[model samples]
Target: MMALQHRYPLALAIAASLLSGPVLAQSAIEHHVWQDKRKFEPYSRTAESITGAIRLSGNNQFATPGSKMTITFGNGKKAQLTSVGASWRQWDDVDGKKVTAEVFKVAKDPGTLLNGNTLCGKAAKYLVFHESLSFGASLLGVAVFEGSKEPKDINSPGLCGTFNYSVD
Candidate 1:
């Protein structure tokens, strides 16, 4: 189970296969869910939102400058969040030298926006840091996808989950 925690970020990568399997494309993949998490009542929702990414090709690092993040609620329901930014670094296997790879992600909730397109609209800003690592499971390496964050800007979005080498 300890390895699962490290794989939290990659949750989104398998989300497609877990939901229906390898038959649809990215555009067709609008919603990613957990096989067991969705079994609960509090997780099922017709009006839900999610955002994340996985390594696809080569080693790279990504991020959004500043310690600020936001979620678009509706036309006027928006929220901002800050998490002191998250960072991770470690060594893997490199021909026997214990080579190391690193990744730094920073996300925050920027409050809520009121009058939006619908009664429930939300969005958040994220940065992906895939230094010397592939992200997309079927494509990249490191995969990190957590719940983002909520109004607290610290408690993590609604789901409070993340992914990395484990899930990847």
Candidate 2:
């Protein structure tokens, strides 16, 4: 009887573990893979809106002389930005080195043309930036993308990552 009593607890524990195994393995929430909806164009400096090489200056300001940055909205409207002086900042990382973003000013205001667009919306002027030479998982480095102050988030619905550029 003493042996059987000890065996009873052991059997109970085994049974409890077996019964709870399936329950513990099951998950209540469902997960799905996320997909990006927007399309990206390749960078071509030849005969492109921006024809000149973007060179960084010692003063932290850069210029794209004889070149213009073309921003095409989702609605098919476009805004051209001259190679006016721009600012730089150390943001993001590539190959363990800090990535610098050179933000250029828009040449002119597109007015209502930029209002209520699918990407970044409603702005008199847009901020364009060139990323340092760096590559990531599946995407290569050295490109230009849209920047916005109001939205702030890099992955926000704004016009970020819409453009692809290569610096000279």
Candidate 3:
């Protein structure tokens, strides 16, 4: 009778674990994929307006006098002017080497434009830079994307470095 009493307690414990196994497993899986929708509300603005200036400068130490840069926006917007006139010299650190860098600047026509019909009734401001040499060599440039409601300062090297713009 004593042995039977001990065996009865063990049997009850096993049954309890078996009954709760599926419930615990289902709760764990549900918790992993759950997301709170209240944190992801969308913006209410539909169009964004941008105004800025673009400038491109190349190093004269490399003797790349014909180095060219261009800026394009949305689909059809592009720099208005293609004049390379400004030149300066400064000490610059390039790839861990310090040297006197002769720089020449290419100015782009400054203007303003609008990008519209964005989804979520909202849009972001961004700038992209492109550089190419007369020898058929191309260097990839940088892009910046910012999501904001106010005017932003858009600047980049080997491209535009000064500008004022707004989004609405």
Candidate 4:
């Protein structure tokens, strides 16, 4: 009986360790990969422009986990797509005016649906705007970040406007 009791404890301990090994290994290997895919719809110039002579040209591929959208404006201002949670900032010269801006994402009502894929949900559409700056008295500086004044249309493609995407 004494020998049996000692062997039973050792067997229980071995079984416990064996059963926990796969669980631990499975959790260690578990990871999430964001497979969201996007496409850039060619933007058309309208009667009302967001920024004068500022054109947007970039490849749309916001997938691969760390992919980014590089938007180049005609005024030499470049806005790189970044996560709002990380607090990113960019500096550029617009029309020869020095400006600093921050990029962030905001949730849209009903979001944007492309090919049965909805974008701009919790971490969707991005907004790049000029950050408010105040210097000494009489030395105040202000930069205007404007989007389309038209009603919200997810399908509309314009500079400094909504970003439409399709998920995989």
For each candidate, what is the lDDT? 0.28, 0.38, 0.30, 0.32
Rank ordering of all candidates by lDDT, starting from the highest: 2, 4, 3, 1
Every model's TM-score: 0.20, 0.33, 0.21, 0.23
TM-score winner between candidates 1 and 3: 3
lDDT of 1: 0.28
Evaluation by lDDT, superior candidate among 3 and 4? 4
In terms of lDDT, which candidate is stronger, 1 or 3?
3
Per-residue alpha-carbon lDDT of candidate 3 for residues 24-141, written as tens digits (9 for 90 to 100) = 9887522100011111111112112232222223222232444443444443455422212221221111122222222222243323344432211222233322221213422222
lDDT of 4 by residue, 14-78 (tens): 88899999988887522111112222222223201232223233323322223454443333344
lDDT accuracy of residue 139 in candidate 3: 23
Candidate 4 accuracy as lDDT: 0.32
Candidate with the larger lDDT of 1 and 4: 4
Summing lDDT over every window of 10 consecutive residues in candidate 4, give the lowest-scoring window: 136-145
The number of the candidate with the highest TM-score is 2
Measure candidate 1: CA RMSD.
19.6
Q: Write the per-residue lDDT of candidate 2 for residues 1-168, one digit (tens) a residue.
A: 677668698887788899999898795432111011223333533212322222221221234343455555434555565544333333332233443333444555444322332222344444544343435323212223334442222332344323343332
Each model's number of backbone clashes? 57, 2, 3, 1
Model 3 Cα displacement at 22 (Å)? 62
RMSD to true structure for each model, in Å: 19.6, 17.2, 21.3, 17.7
